[model samples]
Target: MRLATFVAFLAISTTASPVEKRADAFGIDISSHQGSNIKWSTLKSHGISFAYVKATEGRNYVNPYFKNHYDGAKKAGLLHGPFHFARPSASSGSAQASYFISHGGSWSADGHTLPGALDLEGGCAGLTKSAMVSWIKSFSSQYHSSEKRYPVLYITTNWWKSCTGNSAAFGSSHPLWLASWASSMGPLPAGWRSAAIWQYSKETGSTPGDQDRVSGGSAALKKLALGH
Candidate 1:
């Protein structure tokens, strides 16, 4: 009877296991798929410091909510930036880079513009790992030359291993935004020494979106936003 009671008590316990929350800063990443229900001020009130809004993807697809989210973040006093989802084999790197920059990838020294990110996981469509790396390199290079800053790489260990050869080749120049559901940051990418941000969960606050923790607090993150 005691054993059964113990199990029941454990199941009903409101307290939870420990989770990693030692973040310099916390924020979310959103796209048109998440809709426009986000109230930036309310989120700010809840201590949401920044956000990354989906801009362009592939060669031509733009996030329909890009402008509103960007504006909303500003209106709500949240620092924000744009992200482009990669379709490695669908288009040439420079071509896609052009599309993304033209849409919203351009960064200004303004306080709200965090470094843009290249979301790299995708259906490769037969693109070889070597070719895919080259593609991403070309895109990031072009973005750097044009905007004077390299975009962050958002990726996972498994995807990086299979699709990117798990090499830390880009780590020196491009910071990483690693995604993991574990209670901690877990292992970073093979080449990257540390992550710029860790996407720790897919749910947070009153909004349904990916949650993240910036490595260096709000100051470092804000510097990236200002293109410093």
Candidate 2:
């Protein structure tokens, strides 16, 4: 995440503004399998303000790729956070919350970085709508809001509807990180407009993981994640 590398990544900038113009914000998601390594220079150069690195899963599984990326993100001076890939088959939401706390590195202890994220997708296939909402609530409630008010809720557009048909069940207070790979942010399903961070694509060049296709990369993103 070197500043020089970030500059190189920004060399191919499109017509979009360096900062986003709309209400939402943008960032990238990284995992262990992406293979490409991230450097602070890259993040700085590309104007990347924040990132979410894969942390751990269920009970025993941990993402081997998290440490370096997490370290690099912090070094680059970006607001860094970790996410857990929810495993719906093996454990209850309460159990998953316990596992996430045990394995997901200490963000509060290290620094008041961005809140933790729940990467819910196909992996969370077994839970009913009630169960899914309960799982989210169980995990989010553990983190004292006095410390970090809202933990992130990461989910796809359609999956969110099917999983939490009643968005009200999720409590409107928490901010969302919606993942929609479509060309435009339009067609964003109901109950997601409250999202503070919208992952529009996987095409980001700064972070060495999925290149998120994003709408804008403005300072607003920095404010949302870094609390500037």
- Candidate 2 per-residue lDDT over residues 32-99, each given as its tens digit: 86544766565555656667888888667888878787888888877678888887777765566666
Quantify all predictions' global Cα lDDT against the true fold: 0.78, 0.63
How close to the true structure is residue 149 of candidate 1, measured as C-alpha lDDT? Answer: 87
- Candidate 2's C-alpha runs over 4 A off are 1-9, 14-26, 109-112, 144-148, 188-190, 203-228
Per-residue lDDT of 6 in model 2: 38
| Per-residue lDDT of candidate 1, residues 118-184 (tens digit) | 9987555577788878888999988998998899899988888888677768988787899987778
TM-score of each: 0.85, 0.77
Best by TM-score: 1
Question: What ranges in model 1 sit over 4 Å off?
Answer: 1-23, 203-207
Error of 1 at 158 (Å): 1.1
Worst 10 residues of 2 by lDDT: 18-27
Model 1: per-residue Cα lDDT at residue 221: 83
